[model samples]
Target: MNLRRLKYFVKVVDIGSMTQAADVLHIAQPALSQQLATLEGEVRQQLLVRTKRGVTPTEAGKVLYGHAQLILRQCDQARVDMDAAGRGLSGAVAVGLAPGTAAAGLALPLLRTVRARHPGVLLYLNETYGSTLSELVMNGRMDLAVLYGGRVAVHGLQFLPLLKEQLFVVGPASLPAPPEHVPLRLLGEMDLYLARPYNVVRKMVDEAFAGIGLAPRVVAEIESASTLTAVIADGLGATILPESMARTVVGACKAWQCRIIEPVIEAPLALCQSDHLPLTEPAQAIKEILLELVAALPGSLIAGDDTRLSVS
Candidate 1:
C-alpha cells in the first residue's frame, strides 16, 4: 500500500471531509476522494462511511487510523534523521518533561550541553505531565522524556532509572513550625495547593494519604511547579512537592521546607524512550548530555540504597 495514500486517508478521516482534507493537503477534492477509494480497496474493507454531516470511520478504519498514525510518525522521524545526517551537528531533538522535573534543574543544563556540542541541532522542549510525556515518546512525537516516577509499563518503551526524589511539605515562613518532622495528619488540616490528578506528584500525594487512611483537603490546583511555589510564597496554601523542585527555587520563596514523616513519599526519576526507536545523532548527543547532568546532581539530593532522605 502507498504510504502517501494512507496519509491522505488519515487526513480525510481527521478532517471528516474529503473537501477539507484536500484543501489542507493542497490537492483537488476528486483526487483526494479517488486516493481514499483506492486505499479502501487495498485494505479490502470499507474504511469510511459517508454521512450527511461528514465521513465517519468504520470499525476497520479505526484500527487502520491507529496504525497509520504510527507509520506516519516513524516516516517523519526518518526524514528528520536523514536531514540531520546531511547537515553536520544538525538535527532536531524533541523532549517532553513532567512539570517539576524540568524545574529540578535537568532541562537547562541538557539544552546547554546539546547547544555547545551540536551547534546545529534544534532542541524542542515540551513541559507536560508524565502520562502525556509517555504517550508522546511511545508515539515518536518526542525522541526522549524525563518522567517523574519509575519505569511505567508502556509497550515499546525503555526507562532508565536516573534518581529517586523525596517529597517535601512547603509552607509560607509565616506559618508556625509544626515540628522537626510534620505528621501527615497536620497536612490534612492545612489549606493545600496541589497539582492536578494527572501529575505524578498528585499520585504520590494521594498514595501517601492513602497509607495514612486520610484524604487531604486541597484548596487549589495548579499545573506548573513554579506557579505552585509562587502561590505558596503568597500564602495561598501549603503543598507537598519533590525536594528537587523545592531546592531549585528555594532562594526566591519565603517558604520553609519541612519533612513529612508519617508516610515517606518517594518516586524515581527516569529517562525514557521507545525501545525500538533509533535515535538520530542529535537525539543521541542530547541523551549523553542528560546522563552527564544526572550524574552531576548532588548525591545527598538523590535516593541512596541504604538511606532515605527526609524532606526537612
Candidate 2:
C-alpha cells in the first residue's frame, strides 16, 4: 500500500468528510476519492462509512486508523531523527493551550526560545478552551496541551501536573473589601459572571458551591475573559480566576480586587499527551523548555500543593 495514500485516508478519517479532507490536503475531491479507492483496493476492505453529515471509519477502518497514526508519527520521527544529525532537531510540533493559561507570558517566550535554539524546528500553537484542548490532545491532533487536570477525561491520555493555581473572586476595587478571603458559600450572595458549565472553571465553581450547599448567583455567562474583566471592573458583577490569569491575561490588577476563596480551589495546569504515542524529539525538547519556564514562575503560580492528586 502506498504511504501517501495511507496518509490521505488518515486525514479523511480524521476530518470525517471527503470534501473537508480534500480541502485540508489541498487536492481536488475527485483525486482524493481516487486515492481512497486505490487504498481500499489494496486492502480489499471497505474502510469508511459515508453519510450526509460526514464519514466514519468502518470496523476495519478503526483498526487501521490506530496503526496508521503510529506509522505516520514514526515516519515523521524518523525524518526528525535523521535531520538531528547536523541540523539540530527538525520537524513540526503542534501544541494546544487552554485560554487564560498565560499565553501572553508563555507562548511568545516558547516561540522565541525554539527559534533561537532549534532554528530548524517548527512550532505551531493553538489556544482554545480547556475542553477543546483536551479533545485535541486525546485525538492526537495536538502533540501536547496544558489543561485543567481535574476537568479532562484521561481515557487515552497521560496528564502530568505542572503547577496548581488558586482561584480568586475578582471584583471592582470600589466594592467593599471581602476580608482576606471569602467563604465559598458567600459566593451565592454576589452578582457573579461566569463561563458556561462546559468551561473548566465553571465546573469547579459549580462543584465547590454544591459541596457547600449553595449555588452561585450567576448574573451572566460569559466566555470571553476580556469581557468578563471589563464588566467586573465596571462594577457589573464579579468573576473567579486563577492568580496567574488575574495578573497576566486579565491585567488591571490594581483596578480589580481579588479575594481568595475560603476553602481555596486550586486548579492544576497539566501537561497532557496521548498515552499511546511517544513524543517526537522536537516535541520532547519543547516540553522540557515549557516545564523549565513554568518552574521559574512565582511561587503563587507554580504551587504544587495538589500535584500529588493530579496524576492521570
* Deviating ranges (above 4 Å) for candidate 1: 80-89, 102-104, 248-250, 300-312
Clashing pairs in 2: none
Clashing pairs in 1: none
User: Using TM-score as the measure, which candidate wins?
Assistant: 1
Q: How much lDDT does candidate 1 score?
A: 0.77
lDDT of 1 by residue, 206-310 (tens): 878988888888888887766876787787778887877766545678878877787777777878887876787678878777766776675423333322112
Task: Quantify all predictions' global Cα lDDT against the true fold.
Answer: 0.77, 0.78
Candidate 2 deviant stretches above 4 angstroms: 10-35, 41-44, 49-70, 102-104, 150-153, 300-310
TM-score of candidate 2 on Cα atoms, chains taken together:
0.80
